[model samples]
Target: MGLKYKYESTSRRDTKELARNVRPGDRLYVIHDVSQVVAPLEDAQLYSEFIVTKDKAPFTGTPMVCSASAHRQVGGTSVTSLLVRYGEVYTERPVGIRNIAEEPPLLPEFQHLAARVAREHAADVAVARSEAASSGRRRWF
Candidate 1:
């Protein structure tokens, strides 16, 4: 079995060449203006808060700070091309890797707030799971 690729333009050969030339550790930046996007995975998390930083440091000399971009230890060049379709740029310099520390202590107020948020989310998930189970849908839990 082979992975399928969707061509973005008439130049399918050129696109294939571009994907072939991509290598591991090739740094890329998201250029898509996500100002209007509401999804957290792409907007609040990946492009804005997670993708551009590791261990609290920026990938390079850039202004915007993003987080949670690297969902895995290794990503493919195909992902880079996919992002390019949405206006991202590949950098010549390889991305620097850093070690992330375990969760540190927070202020008492913050801890309380975190606990509340966790409880609320758990309740929401439980409700959703119950609804799904009753409806004979797939059990997400």
Candidate 2:
């Protein structure tokens, strides 16, 4: 079965097309009215003093928007930044693909979102596995 797409409006279709056309190397600056904090992944053993500057060297990465708002490869590790909601982008400290499976910041406000992100990831995995299994022929004895 195929998922039904609502192309009822031209604007929606155009936006979809635009997203489809984004390349991996395209630069998308994740800017906000003020600077934002970036979270480091586990084992980075780095300090948490890093922040995405609003003036220079802003948070930037390849257009791999999904689990993370942007992604960049640093020091051979996969660093992914989660940009959820406005100005809430999580980076892997200095560089590297930040593993989203890791927890968010320890702030009381963001603690609640950690569980939700985990659940969403789990659901995505389950759905993908089911889809793959459903595509195969069933065997009955």
Tell me each candidate's RMSD, in Å, in order. Answer: 14.7, 19.2
Q: lDDT score of model 1?
A: 0.41
Q: What stretches of model 1 exceed 4 Å from their correct place?
A: 1-100, 139-141
- In model 2, which runs have C-alpha deviations exceeding 4 angstroms? 1-105, 137-141
Query: Which pairs clash in model 1?
Result: 48-66, 49-66, 49-67, 50-66, 50-67, 50-68
- Estimate candidate 2's alpha-carbon lDDT, on a 0 to 1 scale: 0.36
**Predicted candidate 1 versus true structure: per-residue lDDT over 57-134, tens digit per residue:** 134212222323555643222433444454433333213322132233465768889999999999999999989989
Give the alpha carbon lDDT tens digit for every residue of 7-94 in model 2: 1123544334323443433332222232233423334332222222222113443234432232532222111322222222222233
User: Candidate 1 versus the native: TM-score?
Assistant: 0.29
Instruction: Looking at model 2, report the run of 10 residues with the lowest lDDT sum.
Output: 74-83
Best by TM-score: 1
Query: Largest lDDT belongs to which candidate?
Result: 1
